[model samples]
Target: MEIVKGSGFIPGDLLSKINSPSDLKKLNEDQLEQISSELRQYIIDLVSVKGGHFGASLGVVELTVALHYIFNTPYDQLVWDVGHQAYGHKILTGRRDNFHTNRVYKGLSGFPKRSESEYDTFGVGHSSTSISAALGMAVASKYKNLKDKQHIAVIGDGAMTAGLAFEGLNHAGVENANLLVVLNDNCMSIDPNVGALKEYLTDITTSHTYNKAKDKVWELLGKISKFGPNAQEIASKIENAVKTSLLKQSNLFESLKFRYFGPVDGHDVVRLTKVLADLKDIPGPKILHILTKKGKGYKFSEEGNETVWHSPGLFNKDTGEIIKVIPKTPQPPKYQDVFGHTIVELAEKNLNIVGITPAMPSGCSLNIMMKAMPDRAFDVGIAEQHAVTFSGGLASQGLVPFCNIYSSFMQRAYDQVIHDVALQNLKVIFCLDRGGLAGADGPTHHGAYDIAYFRCIPKMIVSAPMNEEELRNLMYTAQLDEVKTAFSIRYPRGQGVMVDWKTPFKKIEIGKGRKIKDGKELAILSLGHPGNLVTEAIERLKEQGINAAHYDMRFAKPIDEALLHEVFTSYTKIITVEDGCIIGGMGSAVLEFMADKNYSARVVRLGIPDNFIEHGEQVELYEECGFSPKKIAETAIEILKENKQTILKQGGTSLHDKQA
Candidate 1:
């Protein structure tokens, strides 16, 4: 293993001294700076080797070091918003040895998990949760009358765009809680931030006059305090009034009742520590805006596009060139690629077609579409609520809007989906990419709840595609004016089953399923990509002399009741498989349909266990959850044998009589 050296360290000098956060306290401020450089290089090398989140951790290296050094962490609660930037914090807090295993299955989680370390105050993956969670902890500490401790929330500028962040700010401001919100401003949020608030923050950060005046006011206030209490009060009021007036137009943080500070250079460790140490003495909700570059160290990462370096694959550490993997055959298109390409193709012919993604053009594969039809495709930054309502606005103006949001991210726009789209009955197609276990991204990125949530909303057509062709067809069908309802189509993250991409698009009959094979003893009904497992299970059953029928019930909400009823009457045993949880999922939908008609067929639900799945490879996770083809086959055989034994005991009736 070729070791990359960083500034202020020989090889293993700094790493050897630190075992945990407590070990970090022994190091002085000057030494801590040296360690920060070493840590940054270590992170760079590790990410280069193992392909994990890069830019976020790089941006927070100094801040992470400063926080642990200044604050009595574990006891003095420090919560990281989104937790992508906690890689440094993790290394410092006794996980340095295991850092290489980050994002791997059953290994170190990419984000701060409560189970992983006590220093990690809260688990985070979804953005904008830090302030609220920290404030809650602060309030809980107060309720317990613990006055010695401190509570701080370190959030990125991008995460601050979330509505929940504002909600936390508003509530914390009124509560007068001793909460410190460190806004780690890199001027990006997955993509550059959108909305008026982001622009306002940018303007404030750039305003030299505002910062200089505020500094002079502080100096004047300090001198006046020596005269008398009355003089100090007058000076304080005057300074605040001046600061408020100058910042009034542009300061969103101050308006939310926070004592706004900084636009501080986040990279300056000494300055950051000094500022943080000063803020430790002060009380109430405060905002410390620290500006840093996203990919701070190493020449290529520093100069390279932040987004490309954000979560890059395995790369050559020396050149920062990503190690490209040649495909055995033509590699199947990523689900996002399919969505992006299909939308562009649709937009080329239809003048009304508009594409909108909530700050995930690159992730959702809409970047190409955005480039091709810049006017039509919109990247609405991290504001999912705004994206949905904006799409609604476009729909009202006689445009066919495709609001492509990650299935997990759409949770942020649930209210907008219910009120703006479904309530108004707008023709908007929600292209939900990563609709199930998103592998390494973990539970925070899982698209598990969309089926349950979207199904309940009235006037919404919720569907999932079994393969690439079906996805394209569904996208086409969703665009039609006749489908004057809010439509959603979810698909998994990676490539669909290797099918011929040249097949012409066709509109699949909505709320229908196709019987793929015929059998007598057992049946496997499934939806989405998990349906592929049924084919393997059926072939395995044939070898065992157990004839198993298979049906691909593509639509989850408007289920194919006719096909389901026929299968229920025909088969002695029925199994429903899906990639999602059984509770209120595809299997539950099938069971609900069966119960509505007072039909009872011996049914076995084969799907993800009703528990949050941890980060892992998609294949490993599928097998663990019993969604893999091998597990499906074994499960089917076990259930069939059990049913056969019960039938023999009861003296089995003929197939015709059982149907009657």
Candidate 2:
């Protein structure tokens, strides 16, 4: 409860005494406990000062310390599911110096990156991947005859609900792989976990009466088996019979062929180390379930009002009050907020409207709609595939279902979107939030590939809103029965440039693009939040004595040929920019158009690079990727200059010469 400063902890001199897991070997058990306290306090201070995933890191502080102290990391291969809980892992693994720059540009990444450090065994961002990945490593080690090396996967109880986790469990159990799966049961995900599995775990962890009865049964069986060696055989049959019945009612993990261990006290470092030491020697798909509270050590964070504290902004460490930024005169709502509020308004008018999200009610702002219409909005709990298919079922029943999922998370449900929604041509509105470069959360959170992936699917309508007003209108348009096709509207993460919400809802003529500006020398086509950058680029071009036309081609699919034809006829050069991969994105559509029609206008495409983008501030990343207004304008000018040279060389009248 008390505010623990970094100064009170053991100084750097003591920390410097330990370098690796081998270095931790010298520390006594009591010293290891001090190390855990120091590590927890360090995490509290680090996250409190420079905001990242706080609660996840706080909950795993002791576990992380115990694992490092007990196991030979980097060599032993410790894989963490979800990676949000890797802050303490980072601290102990020689990244303590760079922890201050966590999640910032060119600094420590928010998630595990294999290239970042040798200790980070596998790069992880999405959840429920550790078990399968760790098993693969274990199998590889066996194939190479390196059976002495250990493989451990620390997954949360919430992560265990994911079907992939169980699939991995089944395979590992069947193979009898030497793998340790430590289930960190904190009784929460980003939000509290849902579905039948969560409730089952809750029963196992909380049911004292059931546990007592089971203990009594075991004791009675022991007494009966003591009569003779033959009685032991009878007792085994009885135990198996009772287990079979109990498995039908509870304990899903044991049924999946795992030796389920305790729901132990996760915060107790000494106990965890002892258990882990014991488990290390005997392991074949064994699970040690540990119970820990999120935001365990820090009182204020534990009782914080908002999940904003889960990954909070800059704040006062003492009081835990988020530092309030000076309010501007008026601010536009976040794109997610607009989408959330719009869906609720639409749902109010249409009783058939239903909202769904995959463990992201708060992140996607679907919580707003959920609050307004609790019966209609459902949180499917990190199961994107289920959310999509569930929405498909709802749509089949003649209901308008809106499945709100983050653009990054939607990757998990790609097959479902194709087979269940698009192939079936279900009237489901896929509201994709965080469609572009999501800043602090890093590469895994960037919604860069949604456009390319969704565009190829048959019967799929892909659209991006240039502003908050267009976003609202697009959501309204997608709701219409006439737009019965499966539709997706992707918008970025932050506020919508303070745009007023006075724009009335109307169906945008499908695939139609609106020209925001008129010019002669060059044309600029833009989509999503990057349309603002287009406007800025156009202004900069005008200042440089270049006439540039700008168009907000809202829908990526149905390629606005009419608008393209207009630009093809009017302009000598065309340039396209979007916050997505250029390979098969809006720019590719334009290039395909030019190629199909045999139009010869010089075209330039600017977008995210072909490689994976790392963690950084959004502005810094955009500027680095050449998506900024200044960079786009400069690139446009260079392209236009080359266009004039080509015309001159071809003996055609150049725009510059004609103007002169």
lDDT, candidate 1, at 415: 94
lDDT of 2 by residue, 550-640 (tens): 9999989987899999888777678899999888999999989988998887888888889888889888888988889999999888987
Model 2 stretches astray by more than 4 angstroms? 1-16, 210-250, 648-651, 655-660
lDDT of 1 at 94: 85
lDDT per model, in order? 0.83, 0.83
TM-score of each: 0.93, 0.92
lDDT of 1 by residue, 128-204 (tens): 89999999999998888887689999998888877788889989989887899999888877776777767877888
Worst 10 residues of 1 by lDDT: 2-11
RMSD of 1: 3.6
User: In angstroms, how far off is 484's CA in candidate 2?
Assistant: 1.2
Clashes of each: 0, 0
